[model samples]
Target: MIMAWWQILLLTCLAFWMIIDQITVGILCNYPLLIGFVAGIIMNDVKTGLVVGATLQLMVLGVGTYGGASMPDFMTGAIVGTAYAVMTGKGGDFAIGLAVPVGLLMVQLDVLARFLNVFLLHRVDHFIKLNDTKQAARNVVYGVFPWGLSRAIPVFIMLIVGEKFIRQVLAVTPQWLTTGLKVSGGILPIVGIAILLRYLPTKRFITFLIVGFIAAAYLKIPMLGVALLGFAMAIFYYQKTIKSSEDHESNSTVNNANGKEYENDKGEYEN
Candidate 1:
């Protein structure tokens, strides 16, 4: 796969998932499904890719990163796991199972990335204090670009160099170790979720989490499908809420104006 230009390009793209994941804040742009889908496309296994993407997406659906804290590393797991699955003609579940520990390790990588960012943050602050706008911009580059490249470049090199070695390793590993890795992988994300829930609005939102799980686990709703449904519901709820608020504001303005006008009329008559 690495021999072909297109394959290399796609794989390079797969590595950039880290950069994109770093930059984007929303659920839409995050790692899991996007990486899986990309690998699937590269391998001509779109269904498996999409399925893997969606499954991993659901597993981490309730998880979020707040204030640069560690969360499961979905990018490594999604891209690498999907690539392995595609190359080996394995199922999406295998990709998901394998991705778990990789995802957890990724959290540490993210923490390292954040630590690197502290230097940049300090430089940016220094620039602000010095009132050196141009110097600040330069400092921002010094801080951000290297970190972004650091995230992408090594993974690209390693994925290319280590692809074959990984396959061999996977083949010889015992069932117990593989099972342990997968089980540990699956369980590790729960800690990420717990971390996320700590910063979430409240326990009330937990019900929505359960409902979403049932939808995926039993009803077999794809990750994309569930995400779209949730989006539509949120949009509907937002519009309704906003409209009601606007209506109340308008009504309050009218009432206040009428009261002012009536008071003015009484004063004029007395004058």
Candidate 2:
């Protein structure tokens, strides 16, 4: 399949995303956009791809890195979701909405993949213990190849078989249910934000986040503008807080020394 011109290009990009997603561990791989855009190019439907990509982007806007853990298996969602969405003759909000649940379902499968990868590591370690370098290399290759195949095969199968099932499921699902999923899709980023909040030590940063939300909600400020303002505010707030702390420390030290010196002078005078 990779030999065909368009399929080759798509697979190359897919492979690139897979490699990068593993290396950066998903932090750097924006798979949704890549999948939608590349699939769009292959299918000659760039606008639909962009719309789907942008919509999915917003749906995941609140996702973040937490304690070295990624939000979910975005690559699976990207590849499978894009393929399914495009194949279903849907675009824009509908396609994006469809992709959201597909992405969510893939998370569990991703955990399974992680568990299997861990087992592979143990097997690799066993080879290393025997001083079998070639075996170790083979073990690593075998381990990594399955990980790639696990992702690629399921996605390929979904593209061929799962798309129709998804369409039927969506057809049967009530309007309200789909709408709820869309709403959840928009709000699910909060889970990521909450994960990020664990690292926040000061209330001031929380206040800024609230302010940004208010600006975007009430003031009708653009999201990008609000994000930029929030970033600037966070920087300034932390800098000022740090400076104030240093100044307070210096003042405390100076005052303590002055009190000790005054006590010594009084003792000298009394003596």
In terms of TM-score, the best-performing candidate is 2
The residue pairs that clash in candidate 1, if any, are none
**Candidate 1 ranges with C-alpha deviation above 4 Å:** 1-6, 17-28, 179-271
Query: Alpha carbon lDDT of residue 147, candidate 1?
Result: 47
lDDT tens per residue, model 1, 1-271 = 3335566566665565456555655443665787677777876778877776766776676666787567776766777677666765546656677776667766666677678878888988998999989988887766655445544664565467545776688789888887765565456556656756777775855666777788888999998988887777679768989999999999999999999999999999999
Off by over 4 Å in 2: 1-20, 23-71, 85-89, 111-119, 161-184, 190-206
Candidate 2 lDDT over residue span 91-198, tens digit each: 454555556666666566556656777877898899899998898888776666545655666556555444457768879999998777556655654554565565
**Full-model lDDT for every candidate:** 0.69, 0.63
Per-model C-alpha RMSD: 6.1, 4.9
Clashes of each: 0, 0
Candidate 2, RMSD to the unseen true structure: 4.9
